[model samples]
Target chain A: MLDSRVLRVFREVFDDEQLAVSDTTSARDVPDWDSLAQVKLVIALEQEFDVRFSTTEIGTWACVGDLKRALRSKLGAA
Target chain B: MSAPAEIRVSLDWGGGEPMIVRWLVADRAPVKRGQAICEIEASKATADIVSPADGILVVVIPDGDVRDQEVVGHIHAVGEALPLSAAAVERGPEPDVEGGTHVPRSLRKAAEIRTLEEGRRGSLPSTVMQQLVVGDLVDRLRDGGASLTALVILAVARALRKHRAFNASASDTGVLLHDAVRIGVALDVEPHGLRVPIVTDADTKTVAEIAGDLQILLYKYMTKTLEPDEIRGATFTLTDLSSFGVAWSVPLLVGRQAAILGLGMIRGADPRDTMLTFSLTFDHRVASGREAALFLSDVRKRISEHMVSNDSGA
Candidate 1:
């Protein structure tokens, strides 16, 4: 479920409905996943999941799997 | 028909020494008036040499290291033919040794500076770019009678207070982190060279105060009256290339300083939805990639939060 929402955010950030986002997906996996895109992804994720990320938490994400795990933990805690 | 205008590289005694010249437009190519014809590099600074008239480019000097006030080439009107002297054509590339050719003093100074930077900084710098949504902030600043550059300077200065590593510089003995934040603003004094005047104690200065200082600094730079102390001892540096419509640029790191931030043009169709791209080049030895990214994120967050609060208050 977290993956689905993350994927939706990714699609919105990249404006690519056909982007195949997965657990292993990294910046290199998506052509448009640049630094700017990364920031947009973070903002979109925050708005989508209704969770705020601390600066340290924002820096901890390296891949889609990491994002998924962090979102799951935050959601469970909420 | 009027004689073809002679395009020469004007020397900047106060600018970077011995600038390397690179032609942007090809030789003998038709070019427009005011089109960027070449780029000149001096030390870590670069500037574009624009054509003065619409015409064909007749390169008298090929791309190589050039001194100030050297005649690099000429621009001729369409269908006009200029004779190329054998001596001009035979002028070969720059010789390897200093003794082989008369090297300009500025070029030599630039070389010495390059050697020093390479020797002092053992590791290569890491770069990170972030696209920040700033349409609302730009609007609010305009409404509040504030410049975007002043806002960015304040935001970066505030963030640097939290990340001391970036606000510090490398010394001979060790890393020296300064308590005061002095930010340098890079100005493109075109047809001359780039000049960076420092805004001393930026951390303690209000946005209006910084903007006032920036205006005075820029005025000094334009009039060639800036004191040596005004251009030195910056804890951090910021260059805004947005006026040129540049999307992004990776600015060269200044010696001793740990980081430099470049602000690209803010672009968007809607006034309420514009975004600006910022590129940060930091000395990796001082800060890791994550720290830099987080620092940038914090700066962005602070700017956004400040702007949102302003909007609500207004």
Candidate 2:
């Protein structure tokens, strides 16, 4: 299951209460998930998960599943 | 007064095809010196031809294709009548094209706007893209109740002050550098294409001041109340596509301006700071690739340093 905090962060970053994200959800799935919005999303995610991402990792994630896996790895490492 | 000064379409310094003439002022209209009388459109550039002397406008050619040094119209002194030989008076009205595909007025207007860029597409620009780390700047602005767009404008203006060559126009003599740093902020007017409102004398203003001006200009544009002056006189332009999730875009040059800067989406792994790509497309005729790179570097340095200074003060 996707972390409730991560889902909450997405909703907050997009400023949409109805936004739903699954493991397979990609940037194309969200209308407001643009470049500027993506930056806000990263900041929100860091605050929620208490994890930092590298530039290489930031550029590689393709969907929510990739993000979830990365988050899981970061948490495990911690 | 002396004979009316003939207004001619001068050949574009960066020579290309002849320009299409469209008069802004009508025949027999009283005009002031330096008033924008007509707009000349070539494939690469659209220039507003202004009146040289205060007088009455007498259009020799109401609307048609005109070549270099060809007399398009004249600015006559008061009491001077339209010459009988003036073709505008002779021609009753523009006839509708028969058997021609009927184009919507909106479509024709859109085509008119694209002609200038389409013409110059043949001469490809030298573009340089660099990823700027602007996390600290963005955070500082958010803390100070300032706008990120305004910060970018100030940075660009600062860089332009040092490198005037990037803020220049192509002239018959050479590249004519502008003394004033007017930065055009590209606003998507939506369904109507883009409308760029120029922030005049940006180099002289603070970030807060520039933000205030942009707020007023953007509101005017949204309300359809923007004046002609607000939309003209830009030496450089900035288009931020971050909101649209665009990572990078090669922005097109407006008019005869030397360069355009595009702000892409900001991304970062770390929450405290992020990286955004700044794409600059410049006229190779006015500046070389090295000069363009240096200008971007200067902008990046200025923004970084300014934000740091502001943070320490707070």
Candidate 3:
């Protein structure tokens, strides 16, 4: 469920429909996954999942897998 | 007569500079103390600013970004004249110019102040240009859905990153280097005049992504939804006049910024072998002709390499 929702956020942010964000998905893997996209993704995720990421947690994401873990933790805390 | 209450931005925007997004009502409109007079926004939050006291709103700093405790406007009691003369008190925008009513007056003023006064800003302005041959690349990129403007912008961003001297501002002291590669793009809003919206952190984005960003910004401009933040803060400015068939032009620097690039129309007999003319006007206090030449050479090289990168599927 989280991956499905997270992928939707990516799809909307980059305007790409076929982008399959897997566990190994990183900025290197997705060419358009820059700061702007990340900001949009975070806002969408916070809105859909109703969770918040701290300043420290925001920087720890190196890939989609990292993002999942952070989101999972944040969602659980919420 | 009581003193005119000052309108200030006291909201905490988490270190993000809060500014007057827009006035809710026209200047000099009557309002109660709790009435929302204008909208203010920071990176973190957006809120309507209420009047401090019941009075006639004498807008001083009519619009644009404002610092903390900065007086954007003031509210004076009815029937009481402004402490200062009306002419000296309100710095409202000038009358609309011909074919430029849609454009924000501040933006037009900014363009005038930055471009017209470059020669006398104690900055010895100089220009260096290069004619880049990239007909084949342009044809390929155009067929594959790429904007010439976006391509040039990305190339310029990369060049600025590699050559930080062009990304600096010359001050009374020395050339102050900027950490971020925020490219201010001069967009012709047609009858609205010219607007310089920025694409921030441009060096970190790929050409395709930059195109996508440009698309969104373009849509925002068309819809008149561009924010003040997007229009302010430029490490460097880029203006293109190629559509008009102009050959070469020296783009004036924004404020004390180090350099500005003017792109000319693509020219060549063969569509597959076209050449683009671009000139970079630089602050002589910050960089010399040699440095400007090297920077333009890099921009030219990066632009020409578009084919090779696309061929390699980068």
Candidate 4:
């Protein structure tokens, strides 16, 4: 599920690589990462994980690990 | 493995307009891994591009009208290729659905008027805060001339004709759009945060009209008597803090709006130089990140290319 979800979000946010996901990754390490990319990533993740994120929460995430932790919390609680 | 050496790729202007290279650190003498390869200046500001995959430096456009956001050079990774060509570092297409409502020209003109009217009615009267050092803004206010904000909006409208993503938004049943892009400039007023004022059918308005209308809006906003119509009907809002030292910000998108652009402080390394920082936040449902990036990059390119120290009130 994470595989599919990550790919979907990647495609939705970046458009070039829908199949781009791995165990070790973060937007910071990506060359195309920018503020616009961050917002797009959050919006895409919210749709993929079927979870909602407050602006404040989205602002705090800097990498994929933090997003994964948030996902676990939101999805696990549900 | 031996690390790659660094290089510095420069676009010599020969006293003409400078061209931007897409590859980062593409011109180091003996480039190393993780070193900056090439640097490109879009206008007043230069982004120090880093080497993506370490490699040998090779230049492509010594001087050409290279497209914005295209990679122009590259380095060789250890046991890898030396230099990647400009065609390789392509940005992917933006995600979006095709075809929907188009904002009519008549509607757009009315919307412009209505925007100014709305701004005048509901909000507390305010003035522009953190006045940007852009000479155009200064001259317009002084001569009661055209506004930079309006010109920017018009440019967006033109871009929408081609890209369409920035101009379109999601509606419950289908897509809602304006044939023209309506842009609202967020005027920071003390005590009340930021207030947006509209500049109508910016695409069609003459530079003189924009400057004169913006002056009127500034007066009304500063006096604290903006009408409700002036603030309403904005499809997009822009908040620029280039007057302050802040470099970048991502503004929140308003309800029913497709996008909002945030601008950071403009500064130069030298006290006398002018530079601007820009950022964009768009409704993902309407335009994906790639779309927003391309649109904003276009805006940056226009400003960097057109703006000069004396290019005020024009």
Candidate 5:
């Protein structure tokens, strides 16, 4: 359920329904997801989940899985 | 009903012939302008291709190397009878646009909006015209392996160097005078649109040097390989219509720059002595017509002197 919601955020940020977030997916997977897009994504995620991400935590995210883990930690659940 | 708009590609510098990685929207899906219609993978990285107009996306060259100025697809208006094949939708092979005069509706609308915006900004434009004998100058430029356009740019740059008032834009605080002479050269980038690629510190470059710089810019322009910074920030503009058979024209000032110079076609009563008309249009609020006249006269003097000069063309 968290994965689906996170996918929605990716789709909205990139303006592409074709965007697919898998365990292996990274910034290279989504075209035009540069530093600016990353900032936008972070903002959208914070608004979506009502959670703030630290700059240190954001840099640690290498893929969707990392992002989900961080989100889970903040939510206090798997 | 509005016609279908061609989605031409403008690849960023260093990203030529990028691979069409994937289509973000399905074929014939409704798309809004500014929407990411597809994703392209360049040599260095990837970029999203945004929709140029609001309509249904029709993909052509669906997958492969799509270079600059190449039509990858079209956006047909809603409820319009869509052409089943790419051949039916395309006006022709777009690279050969010199022979085709197809102005996509979206481009036309953009031009209209731009003209309206310029009007809204408002410029008190005034013009001063002069005719110069350009036969020898043309020969000199050819000998140097440069172009008449380069020579004209060189002259305008020199004149701007002497006349600081001509190289300024009006601001609420006061007239904003530029430190360097960056000249904007207008070239007809048909099918795509008119582009004014700038040559920075133009007054400092020799005629041949400017020619070499122009050649690189021309190549970049033709290949749609121009970087974003290649086409901005001009203190003055030089628009050449000499080849188009235009005898005379008063060019409108671009943005807030104080002046724009127009070069007309080479023509004369005696075949031995051909003359080019140079017209300077200035922002009257920032510069007087007398100053504009002096600036044009200076350009004519510089061009005429260079024509008969003994030194090998600069």
Candidate 6:
């Protein structure tokens, strides 16, 4: 299950106010999600979740569901 | 009706991954005479597409469509029938308009200077002229609350009046008082390479009118159509790097021009977290270094006042 807080972070980062976390959402599905915007999103996620993402780990996140899984593991480890 | 020009919105990543359109500006929107049309992620760097003309943006791609390369968008060309595809949209070798080219900086600067000279010859093509006119107007409006090109020119005249040194020129007959002063505005070819196109007798126009003229002038530089009278008569010059993140630059004096002013990028700490740095250079013989510094200080004061007044109005 996706953490509601993490989903909220996504909505705020993309400024969609209407985004939902689902299994198929990738970078392309978001309009304002450019590379620079992605950097900002990552920064926000780290601060909100109190987790550090490795460059390799960040690269592994291709979809919202994928990012959720990574966040879960990081939160569990912490 | 005849066929509208077919503009494709490309999305494929060559390997079949659809690319997303991260639009910076709106569709079918009339873009700033010189601003980027949109930003696209290419293989090497983020590419900012520019508008070739000012017109209603006819949006072909509705923002979220994912496609391959060669996708066309609505063009500025106005006609009953759209232009037939004569060339691939994204296939041209990128003009050295953005990324700093591998060409030596000195060489690049020289080329840009030459290009400016060409623009002064009144040979600047029509397209460039339009862009320069519009861009300059937009810039003035952004800096000042209301942009009547004439009013802006008058303000410049007032600013020059305050600086007596720029008002005088040197010849074999010692120094002479001139009725007018020329001001050159620097245009960035690639948001990096700089070119100066003079606005003839800029001191005479009102600030508002100058704003309108400056927009036309920027278009001339971009389209390569500046007239000789416009580019050749400047007595002083102003270079603005504020749009880019440039902190400052110390420039060499152009021939016969008494002074050159460089406006650095504006930044500051919160309230808003940005800062600004400034540089000014002038002919040591005509205006002492100290005097030049005073002129900058005065201009800074004026700009600060302008900014404050604008904020209040908004």
User: Top model by DockQ, which number?
Assistant: 3
- If scored against the real structure, what TM-score would every candidate get? 0.51, 0.55, 0.55, 0.41, 0.53, 0.41
- Which stretches in model 6 have alpha-carbon errors above 4 Å? A1-78, B1-156, B171-173, B191-194, B200-207, B269-275, B308-314
DockQ of each two-chain model: 0.01, 0.02, 0.03, 0.01, 0.01, 0.02
The parts of candidate 2 lying over 4 Å away from their true place are: A1-78, B1-115, B118-124, B189-192, B312-314
Query: What is candidate 5's CA lDDT for residue B156?
Result: 84
Q: What does candidate 2's lDDT look like per residue over B34-141, in tens digits?
A: 899988876567788889889888876655555567677888789866675455344445667656564433533433344345326543477898887666555545
lDDT of each: 0.73, 0.73, 0.74, 0.54, 0.73, 0.52
Best by lDDT: 3
- Report the Cα lDDT for candidate 2: 0.73
Per-residue CA lDDT of model 5 for B98-214, tens digit only, reads 675666545334443443245236677778898876655555455445567877788888888889989888765578888888888887745545777888876788776777677
- Per-residue lDDT over B193-283 for candidate 6, one digit per residue giving the tens place of the 0 to 100 score: 5656666655565444454466555545544556545654566666666556666676555544555565554344431434445555554
Candidate 5 has a TM-score of 0.53
Residue B168, model 6: lDDT of 57
iRMS per model, in Å, is: 16.6, 14.7, 10.9, 16.3, 20.3, 18.3
Residue B120 local lDDT, model 3 = 47
Model 3 alpha-carbon miss at residue A21, Å: 34
The TM-score of predicted model 6 comes to 0.41
Model 5 error, position B22 (Å): 20
lDDT of 6: 0.52
Cα-based RMSD of candidate 2? 14.9
DockQ head-to-head 3 vs 6, winner: 3
The model with the greater lDDT, 5 or 6, is 5
Off by over 4 Å in 5: A1-78, B1-104, B108-116, B311-314
User: What tens-digit string does per-residue lDDT give for candidate 5 at A8-62?
Assistant: 9999989999878897676656655533355567768878888876544543466
Report the lDDT of model 2 for residue B129.
89
- Model 3 preserves the real interface contacts to a fraction of 0.00
What C-alpha lDDT, on a 0 to 100 scale, does residue B242 get in candidate 1? 71
Error of 5 at B270 (Å): 3.3
